[model samples]
Target: MSAWRWLVTITRDSRSFFFTFATLCGVVPGVIGYGVMQVTNSTNPELEARLRKSARPETVMMGKVNQERLAEYLGELKQKQDTNDRYVAALRGETLTRKPYQRIQPVPKPSDTVTTKAQ
Candidate 1:
């Protein structure tokens, strides 16, 4: 067998070992770090005060939406889904049924003027 294929086979054969290794190396350290952060957040009053003072004021906005507006948003989402479906079909070598994309006009740049004249 080729070296690349052999390596892949070895890795596939040792999947459990890799899982245990990752759990020991990555997940354990991440859990420990999160625990340390939580302890610091609870124990350190100065840090907590500093964090609260710098934090943005929370808005009291509620999640209430009108039925008509919600329906309109759902319709827009469905139209986008249809466009995505057509694009995916075209990617898979199927004929496109949608109209040609419109050409975009170039954006005009701002012209900067200065009063300084070169001799």
Candidate 2:
């Protein structure tokens, strides 16, 4: 019905053929553009080396990212606490199996005092 629809129909039925043809068509224009730009190009190896050595920006960005991660960790801690509190609340009516144990003590002796130093 439309030019684009016709193009789509042709492309779908002959996908491999149309794709290669389209790629070739695109490459010709790109090669022409690159060839034209090649006449006006200059490169500086020193500038490239300096740019490669400038790694501080990446390290600073990582520092900022670590702060965000720390905040996320704190948020996760709060969620864990809420979950633990919920578990405690849910078990409020449940009986716990406590270990049976008792401390032993002897009857107190008559008041006694001992001197730490010779008197």
Candidate 3:
């Protein structure tokens, strides 16, 4: 039988169609990606170790800066940390400011008389 005929024969019911499509769409891509990653990551450990030993720790550090640039970097880091702290505090129900005074509706005095509409 042809490919289309074979697919139809295999997926005869909704359950079969669901299972087949799920396997093709989900499992197949996952297996392919895993295989690709394994092949790409297959390397000589000695080469990796040599390369690591050749590189300087400061050079490998993220956004490595000298003393001249340290102040600016620290200021930015502090600002970000403060903002994140405020956000976390707000999440914890800590009020940053006091609530504003609300206006109250005036109540009628007890001495006020009620009038009936009946004539």
Candidate 4:
């Protein structure tokens, strides 16, 4: 048999067309995805640069001018804590390690496997 015929026989007789086609569909789109990403990156070089810069996690904010604002905020927070009484410990310059306001959820666990135990 010819190569094409051989491929058809092996693929079809084994009912692997869906598997191969599905795999190709997934892989081809992934390969195509990189190309799309490249095209998009090239098209928006400035945006890409901004995104690259932003991708780094920020621990601290910028501008010394904002310090006064922070103090004001802290003062207001202090007053609020005084009124609340529950959070007085927090306002006393004691650092409060906290859960993030908006956090990325944990990655999902891998799925269970489908097994074949032929008797």
Error of 4 at 79 (Å): 38
C-alpha TM-scores of all predictions = 0.28, 0.28, 0.36, 0.27
Q: Candidate 1, 1: how far from true, in Å?
A: 24
Candidate closest to the true structure, highest lDDT: 2
lDDT for 105 in candidate 1 is 27
**Higher-scoring candidate on TM-score, 3 or 4:** 3
Ranked candidates, highest TM-score first: 3, 2, 1, 4
Q: Encode model 1's per-residue lDDT on 1-119: one tens digit a residue.
A: 69868756776789986677667889889999999988866657898778766765542122133454466447758777444654455576554322347322233444544333321
- Report the C-alpha lDDT of model 2 over 9-118, residue by residue, as the tens digit: 88889979698869988999999999989976658788767765785988768977888757754775877733353245346543212222521223345454544343
Tens-place lDDT per residue, model 4, 1-119, is 59978877778777678588769979999999999888866657898678667763442244333675577558758777432432453465333222446222343445545333332
Worst 10 residues of 4 by lDDT: 95-104
Clashing pairs in 3: none
**Residue 70 in candidate 1, Cα distance off native in Å:** 20
Evaluated with TM-score, which candidate comes out highest?
A: 3
Q: Candidate 4 regions off by >4 Å?
A: 1-14, 42-119
The models' CA-based lDDT, in order, is: 0.59, 0.64, 0.62, 0.59
Total residue pair clashes for candidate 2: 0
Off by over 4 Å in 1: 1-12, 43-119
Q: Record all residue pairs in model 2 with backbone atoms less than 3 Å apart, i.e. clashing.
A: none
